[model samples]
Target: MTERTDRTVLLRGGNVYSPADPFATAMLVEGAHIAWVGSDGAAEAYAATADEVVDLNGALVTPAFVDAHAHATSAGLALTGLDLTGCPSLADALDRIAGAARTADGVLIGHGWDETGWPEGRPPTLAELDTAAGGAAAYLSRTDVHSALATTALRTLADGLAAQPGFDPDGPLSQDAHHAVRRAALAHLTAAQRRAAQQATLARAAELGIGALHECAGPAISSEEDLTELLALAAEGTGPEVFGYWGELGAVDTALRLGAVGAGGDLFADGALGSHTACLHAPYEDAGHTGAAYLTAAQIADHVAACTEAGLQAGFHAIGDAAVDAVVEGVRAAADRVGLPAVRALRHRVEHAEALDEESIAAFAELGLTASVQPAFDAAWGGPDGMYVQRLGAKRAAALNPYAALLRAGVPLAFGSDAPVTPLDPWGTVRAAAFHRTPEHRISVRAAFTAHTRGGWRALGRDADGVLVPGAVASYAVWAVEELVVQAPDSRVAGWSTDPRSGTPGLPDLTPGNPLPACLRTVVRGRTVHLA
Candidate 1:
């Protein structure tokens, strides 16, 4: 950990947005906490006692972001390795893969390939992947990270993947088959490579103004050794504070033993929508089949009850309506077993609550379940003619990612990027929520900003760290902004100007055409992690 010293630092000439004093223009940091916050003129008095002073040069300062859900090692690999996220078509993706294979030292692992916007509207086949790989093993995960395309060499490395439930020898693998192949692919990486990848991802997070991250690891996603290594790295205090969550069902002891904050996160209730595996009540429009459900209500109830009794947060990856229903039923049953108060006090969470109905929304609010969601998912695929409409048709697709409805129903919302699925862009995530495809579902800019900052802390059961105030932890970011405007809740695009004399803090102008602020510096616990 970065050693906290008894040094007083003064920051002046910047706009400080704090919950306690919304219009402060300067702040004094005494050790690892805020000592004073007030006007720039008044801050001059602190210079006599300050060991260091920084002039912000009219920048904007706010609380640093916390990503509630992420995959650190995989995201790092994508950052340092071949990335297929920008491939324009199937042919382009193949050419890139073949080129990567020709130069790779060993197995080639890549991520972020989405066929949704492709003109061909389809993914490359296993045969195509094999040809691209030449003689090497390769595994490329789709944008959702729920499915992957692997070469024959990689498949052969997994002993029984060919016979797994979701396996297709000639097509992309989902569920068990994908998990098996992924484990083999990950095993090929050396410990040095893993550490380098992890460091790269953390450096990127700091650049994007993220102060903390919740790493969702599991038996299927990553090994226990990987989680231990990552937690140890966090202890070094060189990067973001990483909170680990092991998503193994009924493994509360293992999670506690490994120093994980939760027993469940990305504990798959079903697969993803793009892969045609997300368990749904009704059949998909294009596939003509109801998606797969990995766990039943009874299984969910058992896990929830056990985790709650153990005083650990329990969560699941539920995207489809059927999976959401199963989660609600399980929570109800767990509440019955343990008292409702006990269950609610645990602050259990649900990841990607995408297909919720009225009842599920109410149930989540009543159970005090935090919705760890990704607004970037909606931004990428939630428009009228986006991939979601192609998958579920118009009506069913329109209901995805109802942020406004969830907020109105009293469900606590925390936002993240789900990196490697979507890039780690906090400003983009906030803009996506504010400018939701369905206008009725769009939230105010302030609400979206708060969700990405304060809500993320609450999701990890750290409610006291996301604000800038006296007695609060000194973690924040400085930004270069083009304009400052406080968006009005009643207007869609207008009514955004603010008067400085009113003493109300103004947020960055996030209207569609306005440029988002660029991060200049990120500080965590009085230590500088990133500086431009």
Candidate 2:
């Protein structure tokens, strides 16, 4: 006999896309999970005996958004960094850095710098960074967060990259150099400091209608602090559920021991587009440099072999076409050498398969590779003369973030925001994917939404999260977009809309005399975690 908890709630009038359902319908949430979903009249039996009945009144409803690739703590840290995200000139960036230096006493760390937007290419150098820091050591990460720009003082302490493959004597550290400094800087954060930042980030995420996050906290070497704080936070029951993805393959054993399941973290083979580090088949358009690769095809294959040997699933970062190809190559090598069963539906992933070619996408289907991509990256940076366009030029840039094509080609799709790079707003991500700048690569809202929800589960190699259905996990969100919740500040609401969900006819115009209201209530796991 099933135990009746007598805790039923009927959400009527809202249009729900069950993610797996054929169409929209109403759902009855009983306690922590959906007990039934059908016609409005079908939920009446439960409504008669329900504790609460919410009238959604024809609002668009779907499963809570899932961010498959975010840097949680890094995003939390963004709450207090010298934000240069929308600066006009290099001087503006310097001014912001100098201002931050005035208050912070410890090593000054910052993010969000793009040379493409600057008048002069990439500012002066270490001398300028040193000047901006005053006496405090400072490190500025690129907008892509794949590379770091370190001051001379910051670089003096580096010993690991003395003879590394990509190291340069006087040039700014593009890949490994910035990576080393990032690790050291992160290690400097106290546990308390990290936790506080994480909490703040969660609060903000909840406000943005994000209920769960797959935090791609970099490789294990770099993400140890982030993971520690994240696990601690989850254990303490302070915030939303955090699925940690540690990128280094060596960390697989530790993660498994830490109770990380299939679809775990591993290195695929590359970096991102903002920096020319994404391993690409061809050289960068303007810079004339072939992107960089982290793991060689053999190295990734060995890593996969390790995961298979240990009965674990693995995923990694791959941004450029070359990087996507490298992952396919590595997966092929693993399946060929390690034989079969150890892999198969483990749903191993490739983070940010942004520049995948038609051929490489076919490989994803052939090898059953899961692609965890950030939709907001394209939305915010996908305009004409954007990073991809600058790096790959018009035709190739048009091919970037080919979501529809990848799906048509049989590649499993998942969406993430890579928070810190992009704020962890699932709806924002959904909206971006729905309206990709290039029409050919545009995917249906349903397709993008599925990727945000169930696709997240697939990325984790599970059938649980990112869905709203009977027999599914009791995890979901209630958004003001469906509930008519209203708030002034979006950063305050959790599990709800950040602004009022005004029912407008179409997309809000961005011209003068018009500003869209960011209002929504965000709830998760049957709890009102955020209100707008």
Candidate 3:
């Protein structure tokens, strides 16, 4: 790795989270790589020569997080614009929109509204949205971002909107209609506005101790301009590193030209469960239909083959058993065509992968597929009485997001926030996985944390970047936390590790209801990006 700056920094007197030395209390960063990790006594040798030395004062230092899947522009817009994430009622959401409409100038773009939990049990009608926007154009995406409510004004701006599948004159738009209106709404943003939003998102990520993010952009999800600008901003080396995944079939050349790491991500095999369009094998409990399937197995096979042949990672946003089946079938078909070794070498990915089975899990491991998952989704919409159960019935819903099973079957897992849908709280994500609503689905907190950190690097085919070892990338965070605990895979095992004899490095106490660690500093590649 190239050095970002010519300087060495000594961070001592802190809990250094490193497997090389579990009881390590100090670390030395030499330019872009970690130079040493050991006891505070050993750090004295490097402190005198270091350009800057910081006494950590008992804080914990660990590898910075990597958000495996995100939509930067949309997340920024939600951060800066209207956010209906916790709006309890439909009326409350409308009132919030009305209030925002009074002050908002350009298109009123907002996100994270789920009607499934609301008393109204449905999204606002087009007329209600129009009134909330004061007859101006407005687009409010559902929590899933697979559907949205677009006012008449915004709908009118989307040429051929009515003819698209999922077009509706009264309620929230789904599928193509939602995408068209979203594009039209985003088109209202000026270049400066877009840049500000992107910057805001990156700034927020750095502040939260995230050192890297995978921007999931596509022709249907966001414009090529958005991806390019985001990549350019990250390249300035002032914020978290960003890698892009452009979801398009047969667009390998376009992905390479646009500097995308993969031609997959948000390459939809189906819609989301909340919208009752997740392409299930059986009909939804709420909706009669089996949901929508965007791509056939053969199409997925063709795309996977193309990507593998081009040496680009291929992935899909599959969230239903039917969709997961299609991905497995297709990827395996591609393996048969391109040879298993060739397909396996690329390490393809599958975003979400919420709805999976034993077969799919085995297939993922066998084919070297990474499950880029968002555990926060379960935190928000899992459990017996949650939205998943409402849509899928308790039996089917209980099987959603079986992380422990996947890991048991040897499937690679990379955790993410899918921000704007779920907030970017990495600690919360790990906690969610550890305390999964379904007890059988819960993984060890340490395992979950590793998935969010090193697993993300592995997903990107970077095997040695996320860990804190000599010669490894110096991308990490310092946190002010109450207590550190070594949570084991077996719940029966002792969690508190006050003795150095315990070989495992401890992490922040992630017991539910306890406050998460506050980021004291965030450094990426030896360059300080955020400090508080």
- On lDDT, the leading prediction is 3
lDDT of 3: 0.91
Worst 10 residues of 3 by lDDT: 491-500
Sort the candidates on lDDT, descending order: 3, 1, 2
- Cα lDDT, model 2, residue 238: 34
Candidates 1 and 2, the one with greater lDDT: 1
| True lDDT of residue 287, candidate 1 | 94
Worst 10 residues of 2 by lDDT: 486-495
Off by over 4 Å in 2: 1-7, 19-26, 39-44, 160-171, 218-221, 262-268, 480-519
Q: Per-residue lDDT tens digits of candidate 2, residues 1-532?
A: 1223446767777655564442335777766677777767777777778877878666545566677777777787777666777777888888888899899856677878777788876654666777887857777777778766676666666667656555655545666666777776777778777887788888887776666777665453346556766866764433467787666655667766555554344354777777778887788887778878777778778877788777777887888777777777888899998775556657678888888777888788888788888888888678686777888888888888888888888788888877688776666676677667776776655567678878887777677666767866545554333233222122112222224233311122222233322425444666555655
Q: Candidate 1 lDDT, tens digit per residue, 1-532? A: 3445677889999899876777788999888788888889999999888988989999988999989889999999999998999789989999999999988987899998888778888888777888889968998999899899999998989998878888987888998999999999999999999999899989999998999899999999988988999989877887788999999989999999999999888899998998888999989888989898989999999999999989999999999999999999999999999989998998898999899888899999999899999999998889888878978989989999989989999888999888889989999999999989988788988888889999988887778888888888888899998777777765355577677765568889887787889999888878878989
Total colliding residue pairs, candidate 2: 21
Instruction: List residue ranges in candidate 3 displaced over 4 A.
Output: 1-4, 492-495
TM-score of 3: 0.98
- Number of backbone-clashing residue pairs for each candidate, in the order shown: 0, 21, 0
